[model samples]
Target: MLHLRVISPVSRTEDVLAMLRVQPGATHIVLTRGGALDPEGDAVQADLARECADEVVDALEAMGLAHTGAITLEPLDTVISDAATRARRLAPGDPDDTVVWEELIGRTREESTLNATFLAFLTIACLLAAIGIVTDSPVTIVGAMVVGPEFGPLAALAVAIVRRQGRLARRSLLALVVGFPIAMAVTAVGALAAQAAGWLSLERIDEIHQVEFIYEVGPFSLVVALLAGSAGMLALVSSKSAALVGVFISVTTVPAAGFAVVAATVGQWHVAFLSACQLGVNMVGIVVAGVLVLVLHPHRRRAFRGTQGARPDRVW
Candidate 1:
């Protein structure tokens, strides 16, 4: 659920309240008469949601009756009667018409279980891909695609940008910038070691046929990435973990990164560069598409706002 705190001039409190009352999927509403502030205006607190938030807010602004002095939204666990259920409700279902920022990043900061697991999985996926590329194994390459953790950061970064959360965006970008290169480097080193051991050879690693599937970076890849990114965002907004997994599988970030590592290992600089370009292109495409989806999708914002108690209104 979303918790909104609003501060406006005293004269506009009722106007704001009236707007809040009509929002759909708003589970609760709380009001504060006046609060301490500098010279701005009186403070009013609202605990509504995304469903009716934009409409109500837009209406208030259009009416010119309410002037927003300050606004804040905090996510809530539940409006449950029991404290245990409240505490145990980890994954809150998003409001029908709101946007949910938490799903993109996972709830909580600094070492949430999902984040930690994603990192670990990413490492494993990259390692496997490196092995696959060195050995020219299609099976291993596909496996790496299934394992990579790049999708989470990519999705989160898009949501952050759409929601205007600079911190979230920075964190997600940091994960990607640091994560991708590290995965590539590790994969390259692994491939080199495999070559020295005679488990694989530079010629085998550089074979065009092995990773050629991704070499054809054309409109198909762009369209697929766009669609996959849209699916990823929808999964995030809808709390569909299984569909998110499918999204990760559909995108080619891990496979391309792995192919690049294999090429770099043998000093096939040209192919390696091409593969890297492919990876970069796919990454940028998916992320940009995801940001657009989040910006255009209301559920994500409303989920962030927690409008369970508010009245429902049409978003489209």
Candidate 2:
């Protein structure tokens, strides 16, 4: 379920109420007339099924609420009312399959932006993976995957291509273009430091099963990347982000980069080259999978067409 908070201009208040009253998925409509001081309008609160959110938001946008007023959607942790249950039952489709596009664009726009914190997390994640590579610990490698911030920008790139947002495309590309090299360089320095401290050695890289997956490019890697990318995108659009943790560990993106750094730092040039190839393969596979998923979904196809058809003044 989703909570909608709307501000409607004085003249549009009746229109807003009429719209909500007819929506089967909306319940518990509350209105406070002449209550808003900022824009001098009415305040409205309603509960609606998550599957129905996009339609309601689209209607509101069409009515120009976005220009004169505001509309906000928030996830409800709990909705115990019978009205809420009925709303969910009356909703047209499965909530998880619905594309809440406004919410999605807002999310990826924030995540794709290049920032210091993103850089720091990316570098730290690769460093953790470098340690995991040196020690041959699957547990530590998974930990590094959990910390990695690369998925956000990668996902952003997929979304940008599908939506035809040139600015977003550039921003997402910038994040990846700049982020990976910086992360790899820092991990290389960390590898050298670990060797100097006697905490790592080149010998472990040859024997570790986990290291082989990082340093070898294989058919199975592409299959895993496809599955992980699809699952990761599902997690994003469905708001079931817990699924993304598995996606993170399943694809050896950061781990491969980290392994490459460690191998090159220790002068294992052949292993480094293979690891780099593995990293490239995973990156391309994930992006392709994500794009395929978005393109394949019927709802997203309609949404994409709408996005492409909209005038430049209209933003989703």
Candidate 3:
């Protein structure tokens, strides 16, 4: 369920209330006249079932509330009211399967930001992966996968393509284009430093076998990437965040980057090239699969069409 808060202009308050009153998925509607100071309007609040959120938001956007007033939706962790239950039962689809596109777009936009924290996490994950590769530690490599932040931009890229948002697409692409090389270069420098400190050497590369899969590009690498991408996207739209950890560990993107940089640092050009190939395969597979998932989602398609009448300048 979602809690909707809307500030409607004085003249439109009745219209907003009428709209909410007819929605079977909305309950516990409350109106406070002259409650909004900033917008100087009436405050309207209601609880909405997850399945009806897109519809309600679309209607609100169509009414120009987003520009003239305000509309905000927040997830409801616990709603014990029978009214809420009835609202959910009356909604069109199951909550778990519904896609709140506004929520999704907001989330992916934030994730795609190219910031210091993103770089720090990616570099640390790559460094951990490099350590795992040198010591032949599968456990450490899995840990590195869980730490990698590369999936954010990848997911953002997929969402941008499906939603046809040029600004979002550019932001996602910029993050990817700038992030990976910087992370790999930093990891290479770290590997060089370790080598200088006598903690790592080219000979260790020959002993690595357990983690050779990081650099061994094959058909299954792409297969795993595609599957993980789909699952990751499902988790995102469905709010099943617990499933994301499994998605993170299922792909070898971070490990491949780590292995490639480490191999290059040691002058193992062939190994580096293969690892780079593995990285490319994983990234392409994830983006393609994610785009397919978003485009094929029935609810998302309808929601996209419904919002076409909204102002082009509005950020969903």
Candidate 4:
């Protein structure tokens, strides 16, 4: 469940309310009315409160009726009701877990740009993974996993499909298409340098049974990516920083790209192909899972306007 606060001019009250009436999972509706101070022509204020289970907030905004109004929806940490019986009536999903769609995509859009920040993050992630592969150190590999910025593109793709935003979809695709190959090339160059300096041996490339996890492209990879994508979307929707961390560690993009570079450095084409396939499979899984989850939890416009720090009243 999610809390919605909508504020609009009195003239649009009926229209907004009518739309809310048909809303799928809205519960606990509240309405408040206020007049303008200047009193020009009855352009009073109307506030409507609702709790919704569905994720149609973004779609609702596109409808254009209340598009111009001032509205806000936020997570309600606690909903306290006096009657235990009434409290039982509340839905199963937690309000804190629910996410507003536009807000979510907005964040993704802001982060998905192929700017200097993206390049910096990507470079760090790839370099760390490359070091891990070369040294065969699990710690560095994990660190690289945590640092990888592939989640942005993956999340962007999910948001694009869920919201049907073609531009977002294309941009995200570009990021992945360009980002992965670039990271691989960089790692390859680094590997070549290391080999020349006698820091890494080409003969050691084929003896990678320990690092098979990075090269294996199987159903399990898909499963992990799906779970990661779900958690990533949940984190984005719920504004949970920890969940985003989980997303960073769960995807195999970094390791695969790094391993591919290692293989290229040593002329191990088979290993490179296998690692690239793993990367592709993980990316597909994450995007598919994210799209499914977001479709289930669309965004809705809110019905209240507050000056500042006005929290929701306790009601379960």
Candidate 5:
């Protein structure tokens, strides 16, 4: 279930209340007139079943509440009320299958930010992968995969394409184009520094055999990427953290980037190229699959239609 809060202008309060009262999936409605100081309106609240969230939010958006006042949706972790149960029963689909687009947009927008923290996590993940490659440790490589933050922008890019949000598409792409190169460059420099310190050498690069799969891109690579991409996007929409982690570990994006950097640092041009190819293949597969998954979503058509003429600057 989702807890919805709407600040409705005085003139629209009646309409908002009437709409909520009639929604079978909306319950525990509360109205506080003149409760909003910033927007200067009435505060209306209700608990809506997950399946009806998109409908309710779309209706509110149509009423111009998104522009004139505010509309916020939050998840309800625990709802013991019989009304909430009845609301869920009245909803059309299973809660786990429902897609709250506003929630998705907000999450992806935040995750796709190309900020210091993003770079830090990416760099750290790459460095860990570099160590994994040198030590030929699959465990360490998996650890790096779990730590990498690349999936956020990739998922955001998919969401942008499906939603037709040009600005979001550009932002997500920028994060990818900039973040990967920077992280790879930093990892390369660190590998070179370690080489200079006698901790790593060209001979060690040639001696590693267990991790060769990181650079050998084949048909299975694309297959795994496609599957992982679909699962990742589905997990994101469904709010499944454990499934998301599985998606993260399933892809070779971070490991390939790290391997490419390390290979390049050791003057293994062909190996670096192969690793880069693996990275590219994984990213493209994930993005394409993600876009398809989101496009096929049941709520996608309504979301696409609802956003027509919406301010491009507004993400949700």
Candidate 6:
């Protein structure tokens, strides 16, 4: 179920109430006159089954409530009312299949932001990747993959492409572009320092038992990337966030970036080139797979591509 809070202009309160009254899936309707101070409007609240939220929100958006007022959706973790159960049965769709584009837009937009924490995680992941490559440790490489934050923006980009969200696509791309370069550059310098400190050796670059897959770009790499990327998108849309850890470990995104830096530091020009190619291959595989999966999503009721002017959506 979803709980919605809406602030509507005083003049439009009746129109908003009328819409809510007509939605069979909506329950627990409450209204407070002049409840919003900044907007100085009436606040309306309702609970609806997850399957019904998207349509309700789309209708509200069409009514311009999201423009002159505000609409916020929060998941109802617990709903004890018999009315809630009845609403769910009447929603005419599978709750699990519902996309809830509003939620997705907000979530992907937030995740794609190139914040300090995002940069820090990316940098640390690359550093960890460098360690894994030099020591040929599978454990460290997996650790770095799990620590990498690139998946969020990458997923956002995939969603944006399928949904045709230009701003989101651009932001996600910018985050990955800026974040990876900084991280790879730092990893290169760190590799140099580690060599100077006698903690790493160039001789270990090609004499590794593990971590070879990080730079061994091949057809299998694309297969794993495609599978991992699809699973990651499914995890995101279905609220199965725990699956993300496994998806991270399965893909060679951060490890590939780190390997490129470390390979360059060791003066293995061919290895560095291969690592870079590996990164590109994985990205293409993930993006292509993600777009394909999302295109088939049941909840994508509307095709949003090239709709930059359809509605005013917040990029942030």
Question: lDDT: which candidate is best?
Answer: 5
> What does candidate 2 score on TM?
0.91
- Runs with alpha carbons beyond 4 Å of true place in candidate 6: 303-309, 312-316
lDDT of 2 by residue, 1-316 (tens): 8899999999999999999999999999999998778777999999989788878887887788888998989989899999999999998889889888778877887988889999999999899898888778888988998999888888887887777777777888899889999999888778888889887676766667765777778899899999999998889989998998899888888988898899888788998898888888888888888888888875775576557545463332
**Candidate 6 global Cα RMSD:** 2.1
Instruction: Report RMSD (Å) for each prediction in the order shown.
Output: 8.6, 2.3, 1.5, 8.3, 1.5, 2.1
* Pairs clashing within candidate 5: none
Question: On a 0 to 100 scale, what is the lDDT of residue 221 in model 1?
Answer: 84
Models ranked on lDDT: 5, 3, 6, 2, 4, 1
The clash numbers for all candidates, in the given order, read 28, 0, 0, 14, 0, 0
Alpha carbon lDDT of each predicted model: 0.63, 0.85, 0.91, 0.67, 0.91, 0.85
113-179 in candidate 3: lDDT tens per residue? 9999999998899999999998899999999999999898999889878877777888989988999
By TM-score, rank the candidates, best first: 5, 3, 6, 2, 4, 1
- Measured on C-alpha atoms, candidate 4 has an lDDT of 0.67
lDDT measured at residue 65 in model 1 versus the true structure, 0 to 100: 32
Please estimate how well model 6 matches the true structure, expressed as its whole-model Cα lDDT: 0.85
- Residues 1-316, candidate 6, lDDT per residue (tens digit)? 9999999999999988898888888988999999998777999999988777877887788778877999999988899998888888888777767777778778888988998999999999999999888888899999999999988898889888877678899899999999999999989889999989987777777687688878888899999999999998888777778998989999898999999898888898898899999999888888888888788887654534223325644332
Q: Estimate each model's TM-score.
A: 0.64, 0.91, 0.97, 0.70, 0.97, 0.95
Q: 155 in model 5: Cα distance from truth in Å?
A: 0.4
Instruction: Write down the TM-score for model 4.
Output: 0.70
| Better model by lDDT: candidate 1 vs candidate 3 | 3
